[model samples]
Target: MSLFSTPFDPARDTALVTGAGNGIGRAIAQALVGEGVRTVFADISAERVSAAIGASKRPELAVPWVGDLAELDACDALLATADAALGGITHFVHSASPPRREADHALAVDRRIWQQMHAVNLDAGFHLARELAKRLIAAKRPGSFLFLTSLHAGTPRNLPHYSTAKAAMAMLVKELAKTFGRHDIRVNALVPGAIAAGGVRRGSRAGAAHSARASRRGQ
Candidate 1:
């Protein structure tokens, strides 16, 4: 057997990963390319997308797409562009999210911030997944979708916008999975904990100090 193996078929699979310009999304996109999968690295920053594709194990297999997913128009554009670049996306990973600001706690966050959070995390995600699933179903092909949620979905992170969006996404996953399973489209969510990566913000002085201590301990 091959030392490294994946359920994916390099010859048949094409992937689209949102927020692939940094952090977990970046890592997942690179890993897919490493496995010989043609992957679209979608992010809001052109610079980050370029850097991510350059850093991929198979740069040639990585397609760069930059757009703000918070806007419905942009989300539609992303789907069109990805479809043009790669005929059908066999694997989808939604990891795009607005960067969390420490000051945007429940009491201090403005309406714009709250709406943007939901726009990117939940609205865009649902739209993309549903559109992709429709394509897969119409073509009679199987596809897989992965949503990056958070442990804060169940517990409070003091960032109500972020937590509530994630909580809704967790439910969205279940709903989509139940509906799509019969169509050979699998939907799932990945809940991650604190990691020293992009998108992670220290909410308070204590949290910052604790993160520093954890870093020092290599935790």
Candidate 2:
């Protein structure tokens, strides 16, 4: 199959991807642009957003947005900007997440940290997806939504805030899919295993071990 092959039609698909500043989110956003799909690369850092778009195969097809999704206002602002830029987004990818720190484990994590994690992962995700779905339903357009969840959603990551938030997101995906399916809006989740990217610190022991296990499984 061709690298850019997808069910999406380039002429029809316009996408909005959160956390496009780095890691899997950046890769997904860039790939959509490469397939000739106009895409919004939304990130918390302006520098990262600019850099991600600059690195895209078709930079002209990339629109940059910088915002903290932890706030409801920012979520509303993003939907407005994306609609203005794309004339209505047909694809939505929720990959935005607060960086996870090893120190933010169950006991060590503060209320502020826990709240921010849920605010971005669960609250912002639901708000953005539902709002987008509403627009698509009103327009009578078929759309697709993808959420970047984690294998740790079910397993303990020792990071209660991250794991718990993801677990809720897994359920959110089911709830959204069931509700939006009749509207022809598909909702799904991508539960990725340990990768040495994004929030994963380079050369961390946990990363190395996971990589080793993944390689063994492949072999």
Best by lDDT: 1
TM-score of each: 0.92, 0.90
User: RMSD (Cα, Å) of candidate 2?
Assistant: 3.5
Report the C-alpha displacement of residue 62, candidate 1, in angstroms: 0.5
Clashing pairs in 1: none
User: Candidate 1 — worst ten consecutive residues by lDDT sum?
Assistant: 1-10
- Tens-digit lDDT track of model 1 for 147-198: 9999999999889999999999999999999999999998999999976564
lDDT of 1 at 163: 97
Q: After best superposition, candidate 2 residue 42: deviation in angstroms?
A: 0.2
Question: Which one wins on TM-score?
Answer: 1
